[model samples]
Target: MKLKSGLMGTIAALVMGLGAAQAEGVKVGMITTLSGGGAGLGVDTRDGFLLALKQAGDAGSTVDLVIEDDQQKPDIAVQIADKMIQSDKVDMLTGIVWSNLAMAVVPSATAQGKFYLSTNAAPSQLAGAGCNARYFSVSYQNDNLHEAAGAYAKGAGIGKVFIMAPNYPAGQDSLAGFKRFYDGALAGEVYTQLGQTDYAAEIAQIRASGAEAVFFFLPGGMGIAFMKQYAASGVGIPLIGPAFSLSQDILPAVGDSALGIKNTSSWSPDLHNAANKAFVAGFQAEYGRLPSLYAAQAYDTANLLLSAMAKSDVADADAFRAALAAADFASVRGKFRFGPNQHPVQDIYVREVVKVDGVLTNAIVGTAMTDRADAYADQCKM
Candidate 1:
């Protein structure tokens, strides 16, 4: 009889514990492009979140990360989000890289009262009035990075710039961002369809336009194609862009052609910080290749989550959210803080492609930009 009563007590305690967690643990849904060309960004994000989880360890977090791939499709993203919110019952959702995808996914998540932390992708709509307390951007606004590129181009005194990007929201935003800081004459601003493989028409137009420099924002496979075409065209003009195009993945593909090209970025493998040094060493040891900004950002996002979890009861979602808002995480980026809008206010750097030990890669040129504030910070009334 005593043994039976003891077993019954244990069962009761277990049920109560679960009930308490149901009332509190901040379950999260993570959505990203886990397959196809943009997979690198997702891989990096996953790794970062994992790193944070490991570091946070078993605090009070019965925290569950429900991972799903959008497959770079809007329909898949929405479907996955619905399953997470309704069936899986997640309290928060994060991670979407493409602006088009984020634009579609964010509204529903916010409307349903789930906090969304954007690991990447900054659509202008979120910044200008669509802002929400349920939403926070751990990355910059869509235009911030491109704006840095524009500022650098202006400072370099480039006479005329031929801007080319896909006719997507991000592409449009990038051109506007560049134009904001660049006071030079526009040779021509051409918009191509998303995933247009052949750049012959655009390249020919660029050459004929007689622009002194070219600015582009093509992440993943698109970037690889365009840069290769630019090199083949004998475009002598300086190739300057944001890291999205000329990143770690595209660097190997672009190879020698990208040598001397410049791109602005938040992180580079060559960064000298202890955390950065350790990360590059470990990533190289694991993947046998250098980590890109996508990888670094994902890594930081995970670390941020882990840090916040450690500071508060993961089961207590509200407390964890409060801790995250007061972000005191040790990011590989050294010190980064979340702005009112949940976007990070961090320094930006300019890196140039240089062959290091016979491998063509981006080398940190200099710090062209520094700790800059995003335009939408004040709007995040949180």
Candidate 2:
């Protein structure tokens, strides 16, 4: 009888331990553009996130990461989100790379009481009136980098600037953001089709506008296309854009044509921080390539998740949300915190593309804004 009682007690203890472990473990569903035009960005983001997870040693033990490629399609993203939420029962939904896809996934995921941590694609609506408690953006608002560019352009004494972006939510945000801080006269504002390759017409317009400088927010293949064409166009006017346009992932494709171009971002590989130095070194060693801003943000997002998991069990939604709000992770950006809207409030820096040992990359040139928060944070009711 005594032996049987001891055996029963041991069995009960084992079952309870298993239950506790299950409660602590989290299931994450990441839907991002993995194929097509923006695949490089998504691939870098995934690789960075996975690198962080591997460093944490909790990827398979404490976290189950399920990644799906949206192919930059909003409808497909929505379908994947629905599947993740209803079928896979993911504790979190993240990694939508495009603003339109984020708009389709984030709100719905948050509405269902699931946490959505954005690594990129922080649309204005989500930062403002549509903000939700369950949603947090590890990346800057879509307009933040452009606003920094505007600030830099204004400070550089640029009198007339030509600005252009893709005709999308983020693109509109970019132009509006640039206009907000730029005191310079507008030479021209053009909205090209998203994923546009040939910029011959836009380049001609920029040349004819008598602009002192060109500011653009084209990302992925569009930016690569524009930079290559602009270089060949023989336009002597200086070109400035957000870091997305001149990211490390795309800089090699743009080659020396991107040299001397300045862009604004929150994170750079050259940032003088212990965390950043380690990340850059590790990323280079692991991937044999320089990490882009997208990769940095995604890496930060994964670390943020691991930090929150250490603080609270995934089954406890409120506790998990509180833990995430604490922002208790060592960020690659060094000084990092969350705004009232749960978006990042951090410094934005101006980085100039330069060739380092025959490889194209960005080097920090100046600080554009210190501890900047998004303009829409005040509009968030939460």
Candidate 3:
């Protein structure tokens, strides 16, 4: 009888160990701006996630990361998010680079009790009244980066600056953000059609307006087409914009035209940090190009999630959420933390576009915005 009882105890212990092992492997669902015109953003997001996983290096953790593409379409993003969450039964969901897409997926996914960690796309609604307890933004609010641009341009003594962006929801938010921080006279605010190809009328308007500087928030192909045409249009007004337009992707195509442009970006390949330097070098070596701000943001977001996972009891969703809320790790941007609304409170750097060794890149010229959060946080009742 004693022998039989001992054997039963051993078998029970083995079963418990197996259960614990299965629970330890983390599962993540990542969806991003893939396919269509903005697929580059997805490539960067996926690469960053994988690179971060490699860096964790035997933190005694395993991850099953399921990735999908949004194709830059709201309907596709919704379908992908629903499928990943339902079919994969993922522990967490992350990485939506577009605000419109995020707006679609967050409510549905968060309602299902899945923790939604947004690596990009900071819709204003999420930060304010529409905030969700299960939804956390790993990146800053949409306005935060644009406000940085405005702050930098204002400090540069840029007077009568012309601003332009696609007349989409996020684009309007970007313009409003810049205008908030820029206490300068407006040359004009031009709302071009979302994907307008021609900048001839805009260029003529800018020339006539005589703005000393130009600020814009055009991402993806919109930015590429605008910059190429802006340069071809002979509009040379000390152009400034967010890092998306001045990104490595668009910069290479624009060539020397990107030079002498001043801008503010959420992330840069040239941040003076060991991790950032390594990330820049390694990503460039592998991909044969410098990492864009999108890449940097996604990379940092992955590390932040990993850091939280490393410190938390993964099986305990509340504990994991708490760890992420605290934000204990140093990001590629040096230091960052979460506001009460779960948006990043981090520094924004003022960078200048220049050709270095025949490569178009931005140099961290100075610090413009530091440890900044969105102005909408005050409205967040969460």
Candidate 4:
């Protein structure tokens, strides 16, 4: 079921009665997974985006936000994108959580002359030959953290490793990203069904593979289920993956099972910086929880849009695009810049899950890669 934001309803009513001058400022439509198994990721993305706008106060009021739940279905996301572009006439689109949904929506949205400021879901296809001037990812490419995980694995001296991910575009990128850095024997490689909860078979395979470590990229509820089952199954192999698989959003559910698991991320709540400190405090004050990587990216995406709006009118496509490309906003990730493909060029850090004051959270343990640019950036002609 597609759910519309109540704030969007109020904004739509206000827009209907206003003349062009009265209905000023940018109209943004957000299509994201807000239901089913992947709700946590989408919820965090939505909350983070809104939290940034909320902090903007008067500046935030310049944006008329419209939100819709994609329900984790590609077809549903496409339908929403079409409505937002053709009917709603939004100036831009943002806030898609899953890569599959992003694949369904981004290209068509940008082709129709609407900018897509991605909050998450930066697939390699969009970052490479499929790049568009109007498409900008506020988050890292899908392979970035996975690549860092691979580097960590290589540096940690794990001779043999078993890897797994969901069978999807992001999953393909995940394993390929790991292989790009890890020059080690793969005891086993598996691609489980996307959104699959049961891991009995996969765990059995990991046990028999003689692997010294296991790396898997399962996000949202999938990760929670897998981690719980893996811990219960008595598999002592170290678990590793990108932050999405072990971020703040899932840590509470995964509980002690996630302790000591090393994950790679571009941002963490414990990150030392002025912008990050405010973001973490504000997120907890607003939502009563620590912000996840998804939240940090979404918060940055909102600020990026706001900053561009301040410099150029969205109606002026060229000027507005240039404003966005400048990336003048302070990112919660600290040092953030767009690569040639409009994907992020930033540091990826290794984090170990730990309890601080009995709350499950990740602590930065080491730097995995610095000033890392995705391998596919050179392939992007734009």
Which candidate ranks first by TM-score, i.e. highest?
2
| Candidate 3 per-residue lDDT over residues 1-382, each given as its tens digit | 8558657856875877844523355678888876766777778877876777776777524777888887878898898877887777787788887788888888899888888888778889888988877788877888877898899888878889899987766787899999999999999999987656678888888888889988888787778888888878876787888887787767877778788787887677777888888788877777787888777777787787777777775667788889889888768877778898888888888888988888889988888787898888888886
**What lDDT is obtained when candidate 2 is compared to the true structure?**
0.91
lDDT for each candidate structure: 0.79, 0.91, 0.80, 0.91
Candidate 3 lDDT score at position 319 = 82
Give residue 198's lDDT in candidate 1 (0 to 100): 83
Question: For model 1, what is the C-alpha lDDT against the true structure?
Answer: 0.79
What's the distance in Å from true for residue 341, model 2? 0.6
Candidate 4 least-lDDT 10 residues: 15-24
Task: Residues 48-144, candidate 2: write the lDDT tens digits.
Answer: 8988988887443677889999999999999999998998879998888899889888988999989999989999999999999999999999999
**Cα displacement (Å) at residue 168, model 1:** 1.9
Model 1: runs farther than 4 Å from truth? 1-26, 51-63, 314-318, 378-382
Please say which candidate is ahead in TM-score: 1 or 4: 4
Question: What RMSD does each model have against the real structure?
Answer: 4.3, 4.7, 5.3, 4.2
lDDT of 4 by residue, 131-194 (tens): 9999999898999999999999999999999999999999999999999999999999999999
Q: If both were scored by TM-score, which would come out higher, candidate 1 or candidate 2?
A: 2
Candidate 1 at 71: error in angstroms?
A: 1.8
Per-residue C-alpha lDDT of model 1 across residues 1-382, encoded as one tens digit per residue: 9569657856876878755533334578999888987777777777656655654557324457889898888889999999999987787888788888888889889898787888888887787668876676777778877889989888988999999888888888888888888888999999998777789898888889889988988888789888888888886777789988888878887778888888998777887788787777767776677777777776676666666665775556577678777867666776688776767777888889888898877788777667876765665554
Worst 10-residue stretch by lDDT in candidate 2?
17-26
After the best TM-score superposition of candidate 4, give how far the Cα of residue 335 lies from its true spot, in angstroms. 0.8
